[model samples]
Structures are given as C-alpha cells and as structure tokens.
Target: MKPRSTGTANGCEWTSGTSPLLTIRGLCKSYGTNRVLDGVSLTVRPGRIVGLIGENGAGKSTLVKCILGLVPHDGGTIDRRATVAAIHQELSLAGGLSVTANLFLGRERRTRLGTLDHRTMQREAAAIFARLGVEIDPRAEVESLSVAQMQWVAIARALSAEARLLILDEPTALLNRDESTKLFTVLRALRGRGHAMLFISHKLDEVAALCDELIVLRDGVVVSSGTERLEPEEMARRMVGRELEALYPPRAVPQAGTVLRLEGAFGGSFELHVGEILGVAGLAGQGQADLGETLAGFRPLRSGGLTVQGRPVRFRSPRMARAAGIGYLAADRLRDGIWRDFTVAEHVGLGDLPRYTRRGHVQHAAIRSATERFIDTFQIRCRGPAALVGELSGGNQQKVSMAKVLGAEPQVVVFNEPTQGVDVGARQEIYSFIARLAARGVAVLLVSSDMQELIGLCRRVLVMRAGRIAGCVEEDPITEESLIYLATGVHGT
Candidate 1:
C-alpha cells in the first residue's frame, strides 16, 4: 500500500506512492510493574517524516529503545525493511575521540594491509561536514567542541551511516533558530532523497513544520495518529489530555535591589536585581557557556570581582557558590545536572544536605519526605522518590534539576536552557515556576539558545558576539528580529 501523504516539510512536497520502511503492531513493554508502552503501533514510510510527540514519561523513549533493540519489549512485533539509525536526545558520541574517529568508529576503513586508513577517514569526515553545511574540523576532539557543534557532529555521524530510517529524539533542543533552520533544510533534502525519518521532538511548532504525519503518545499509549496535519494547540491538548495554557507565564516586576553583580567578567559586566530575570543570548558558542559556568562557579571569573548581596566573594566551586546563596540549572541534564544512578530523593536533597541531615548522619526519612513534596509540587511523574533518576523521562529529569536548584533556597539562580527538552504542558509549568521564583524576589540569569524563552521570560537580554557583549535589548516586548540582528551582526530592515 502507498503511504498516506499529509503536510509539507519546509518547502518539500510530501512523497506519495512509497512503501512502508518500518512497521510495528501491538507493541508493549513493561518495566516490572510499570507499563511503559501499551499496544503502540505506527508506520514510517520512505521519503516521508513522521513526527513522534508526547509528554515526559509518555513512553516515547521506550518505543524508540524497543525499535532500536536497546531494550526488549514484552509483546510486540517491529518489522524493519530498511537500514536504521538513531540520533539520541542525549549526545552519544565518544568525548575523547576525534571527529573523524567518531564518524568512522564502528564502520572503519582499513588498508589492504589491515591497518587503519586515517587519510580516507579524515577526508570522508570533512566531506560529510561539508555536505551538512557545517564548518567543523575533523581533527577536533568532540569534548573540545561546544554543545551546538557537538550536536552537529552527532547529526553528521548519523548521516554518515546512510541509514534509510533515521530516528531523531529532541535533535534540535540545543540548536538556535538559524542552526535549526539549516538542519531542517538538510532534513528536507534527505526527505527528497527518499529517506524516511521518525522525528521526535517536544517543540510542537517544529513538528508541525517538518512532519508529514503526527503521532501523539500519552501515558504509554498512542492517543492520536493520522495523516492529517495537526496544529500545535491540538497536539498539545492531545499530549496532555486537557486544554493547555500559555507556554510562557505572565512576567513579574523586578524589585529595585541588586542581588548579584559581575564586573568585567567574561568580556562583559552586568547586575541582576532582585526578582529580575536577565537573559543571555547569542548564536551558539558566543561565550554564553563561559558566562553561565562562571556564574555557577564551574569556572573562575577573569579580571573581575563578583559580589552577592553587597558582599564581594570568589567562588572556586559549586559548593562555594551555593554557600553564597547561588544556584545553577545546567543545560546538559545528563552530564552537568542530574545524577543518573542517584535516587530522586538523593538528587533533590543534594542541593541542601543540611536540611535533610542532622549532625553529620544523613536523615533518609526527611530526604524522602522532602522529595515526595517536590514530586507532588512539581508534578513529577515517577513511582516514588526512591526511583532512580535515570528511570525518569527527560522532562521529569529537568523538573528534578529545577527542584534541586530551587530547593536550596538560593537568592540567585543561573538557569541555562531551563526547558530544553520538556514538552508543551511541562514547559508551561516550568515557565510558571520560574515566574513564581521571580515573584518571590529571586534573581535569575537565564542563559538560553531558544529565542522565545529569552523573549518571554527576560526583562533585559544581553546578546553576545565573538565572546563579547555585542548589544543589549530591553524592549517592553522583545522581538526575535532585534535579537537575531544583534546576534548575527546583520544590519538590515
């Protein structure tokens, strides 16, 4: 049977008369008592993009895992007729490996003498990057690259495999608008070439813009699936089973008191007032990472003095930053933020161990009680506080990260990409949570690549270019155009 065609992808017309590349029937998976996927079924056809969307803990990851054979399903059948590859939500590249080595990791080229062929691999790696229209050095180590560049590397690696069926999970979460547009162009090109893709993202607008079909999953079941195009609002409603509120909460007024101050640090100086959310924005790799790291105490400030609540202090570590009433929400939830092996209770209580501790001996009951409270307050979906953090979904993990930061009662917070991989419903919740923080007089420094996030939540945004403060925009209603022009140095109407 021919695949059903629906919406246009970018400018590419939907492909018709194509056979199914992959199919599943009655797919079910269970982790002990938790039913992650229940009777899920879907079809991916060649020359089309299928958008898989859902809320956190909605079995999207489990379905992907079962399809990739990373996990075994309880009862199901997944039929695959084409070569498959998956771009993970979390980066899966070897950090210590070079770009060239990572691209040719398992599928290595060797000379007739059975030795590794370095020249051919490097040449092919460069060619792949060129094909993707990204400028990346093949010799550079993956760990040395910035997060956006690393995401490009991951995409290039996936394309290098030349798989016909590609599964991408939250692929554009770390990418800025320009970068995302470029990537979408590339995906459109791939679709034109008859490659099938299962695109999983929490960004509803992206799903609407790029997919030929929409599949909505909630609570481990497919609630909506069709060939017709679904609007963002309809998709959000289906994913959460209710009418969704605005993605961003109403802004609060900032109090007139400087809560945190940095002078000449990382090529800029700024003061954060009480109850104010100051945004840091720019094209990727424009010193925003360094600024966030410095504020969070991961890196030392260079050529500047840091002050908190009128007290000059230097923080060489996170502990020192926390002691000085500062908290940080890292962009990379897997690496710098949450501990996968730690229990929810342990991770939440980690921010303020003293509250749950009594004279050096840890208080387990107190920790569990506090974590349970957070789970309820934040609406985190999991079995209990004792559940491993790794078992939680991406959005829930992010919620836990926010809980950990806010639970410490810090006067200032550095939130980097606070809603990177969260779904629409959870995004609203998080926006409200941050707004409440601002209402309570907490100073927030929001470092984000998502422009809407900066526009929606920040009172003043500092746009960076080439590791310096390029411009600052403080419009009553910030426009994406102003931020883009400042970020790219493009002077135009």
Candidate 2:
C-alpha cells in the first residue's frame, strides 16, 4: 500500500477542496423526557476514515440511526450524496435467508427481463469472501453461520450495495484478533480508493491505528472534533467527563478458605481453583464455551465433582447453580441474559424480588429505588427503570446483565466476554468494577478471547488449549506474546 498524503493546503486531511462527502449541522433527537442526541454535528471528507468514540447511551447509535433514516430526529440538517450503506452492530440479516440471497435482498441484480441474477450473486459473493479472508459458503443459511461470519456477511452486503460512504458499528465485537486484523487490512485498502467511512468502535487502539480523524461525543452532543492526534486516555477522559484513575485496581490476597472447588472437573479435563480470578483465554470455539457451560450446569458434566464451601453440589439446572452461590453471565446477552420486552427494573429485581416484596406483593417503591441505585452505580443510561432493556445500547444492556448477577450477591461470578461491544470509557468502568468485586472477596472467572482484557483483569491467568489447561501464569508475569504462545500450543516461556 502507498503512503497516504495528508490533507492538502487547508490542514484538513483527505480533501483538496472545501466540499465534504457528508456533513451534519445541529442534529437533535429526543424520546419523551430522554434526549439521546443534542445539537451534534460532524463532517466526513471523501477518502477519510473518521472514528466515533463515546460511552454507552452517549448517542452514538442514535446518531447512526438518524443518518440511516431508521429513526426520526427532531432537528438536524444532514447533507450527503445518495449512496450510503451501514453495517449495524446487531445482525440485521434475515435468519431464514441464504447468504447469497441476503446479500442482495432489496437490491438484487436483474437481467434485461427483470429476473433476479442468481448466478451473478453467487459468483460475486464468493469473490467477496476471498477478499475478506473469510471462508463462508454462499449457500449456507444465515442462522447457521457463527456470529463472526454473520458480521462478515453484513460487511459483504454493505460492499455489494456500492455505497460511497460505509458505516461500520462495532464490527469487531465478535471477531478474534486474527479476524479483526484481516478486516482492518480490507478497510485500509478501501481507504486508499477514496471511499469515506464512519468507523464506530470501543477499542481505542483500533481507532488510533485506522482512523484519520477523531470525533468524540458525550451526552448526545459533540464534545470535541478536529484533526489532532489524541491519546487513548485523553479520548476516554473527554468522552466520560473525568479522568480514569486506574484501569484495574490492585487485587487483594485471597483469604485462606475454600469458597468453591471443582475436582477432576472433567467435562474434558481441568480443575478450577477457588477464590482466584481464573482467566480463561483461547481462540474462538476452542472449547471454552463447553467448559463454561459444564461448570454452570447448562451443559451436563459427564465426570466431575463440584463442591461449594466443602459440601458436594449437583447442579442439574441454572437455577440450581445459582442456589449453590454460583452466577454465570452468558456471552449472548440478547438471547440468554435478557428478555427484550421486560423493563430494566423488572430484570434487575429478578431472583431477589422477595426483598422488594411486601407480604407476597411486589412493592413498586422498593423496586424503583433498587433499580435507581444500579443505574447510578453502573452509569446505566435509560429513560428510567421502567425503560425496556431492549431499548438500551449494547453497553448499557451489558450493564443490566452485570447488575442482575451482582444484585443476587453471588459468591462466584463467571463472565464470558463481559466487555464485548462496549466503548473505551465503559471498558475501563467495567474493569474497575470487576476489580472491586475481587477485592470484596467475590471469586471471578473471566472467559475472554481478548488477551488484553484477560491480562488486565485477572490475578492468575489460565491458558486453555484443546479442552485442557495449557499453563497458568501470575498476572505480573503475563504478556500478550506469552499468552499467545500458550493459546496456540507454542509453549510459553
């Protein structure tokens, strides 16, 4: 790839003239008493990639919705060319459709007779997969694909639309490191072709590496925007209106007691220690899910003994696991963690509703107070406790998931990709919260494909390979290179 030339003459990158490919002025959006976006404005020049950074509920999704015409904004002036395509964070593909069919759903290529060009669609989709470094079959059903592959199909759909300006929202949430790097390479090639991109991601390092300009939003408004190089810490501080004192707080030594234990914990083979933040690290689909499910009783353990506080426990169901002081935060928050139609208060108050009930009747005031405390503590942005969980942003929804488990005051917490799809500010907040949990004597088992999240949050990192523990390293000695060696069966130093 040739080195990109910085903006010519006017100190703006990627443009020789004044006209921008996309421009917005005085954008405002509100739903009842909650204002999502307020007077937000931005400009994207052709051939430039702009990174959008903000906390959950800071209006990132709302702004994207307004641009895509998915939602109506109260006030705004958006000037843009006609060709635009967006890959939302959520999977928007129809589950029943095949990959090739979904790629050209509404904008199918037509013959002279107006018939759908099925052959052309299949051939083009194969070429796209080769370019994307993915191995997805064109005839595969959308529901049959993994989440990462589904995201790639969404990208292919956007490219098939011949969009001049492509918007990608948290595109790497479900992808592993190798997959994400490959996607970045594709984006770099597209940038060279003068296609404008609005890249929204929570990973600060990715923004620094890929984006030519930075736009930071907070509380539904653009707090800062310019052609400047801002460090991740500075960017995070601006987005959250405060300095993050520590990414991960110091961990206290565990007390000399066995809170929980798994002996010969062989769904396959491994043992989990109690009172330690056991970091489970591996590539996607490397049997971590099997181990986690087996531990939580979601998957049957063919051979193993799980003891809590020195008493034998048999967890035949999720409820039984929770009854034995164990809580699991699932990876698929939308499917397993939350009921979309349920209100935030109702979700949080679950499992512990008896505390807020008066003589067998639910107390509205008590439930409201409990929900408000979680909102303030977790910084959950919503209309109110009564706001539906589905209405919240991805990060806020994850917060509700965490709140649900913590509200039960469980002795052990297992988090699977806890910070997936969350922004930089929210990531730091979650790291701090998890650290606090460990300090308060709550044993945490963190399962993640992101090595950084593991090394940052775990006290003892356990590397898993082929359904077994490859090695264990104290946090002080862990590094990205060392972790990768263990993950890939390369023998760590």
TM values, all candidates: 0.90, 0.89
Which number leads on TM-score? 1
Local error of candidate 2 at residue 158 (angstroms): 1.3
Tens digits of per-residue lDDT for model 2, 257-320: 6676766653233334454677888877777777777667798766667777678888788888
Candidate 2 TM-score, C-alpha based: 0.89
lDDT (Cα, 0-100) at 247 in candidate 2: 74
- Give each model's whole-structure lDDT: 0.86, 0.80
- lDDT assessment of candidate 2: 0.80
For every candidate in turn, the CA RMSD to the true structure comes to 5.2, 5.4
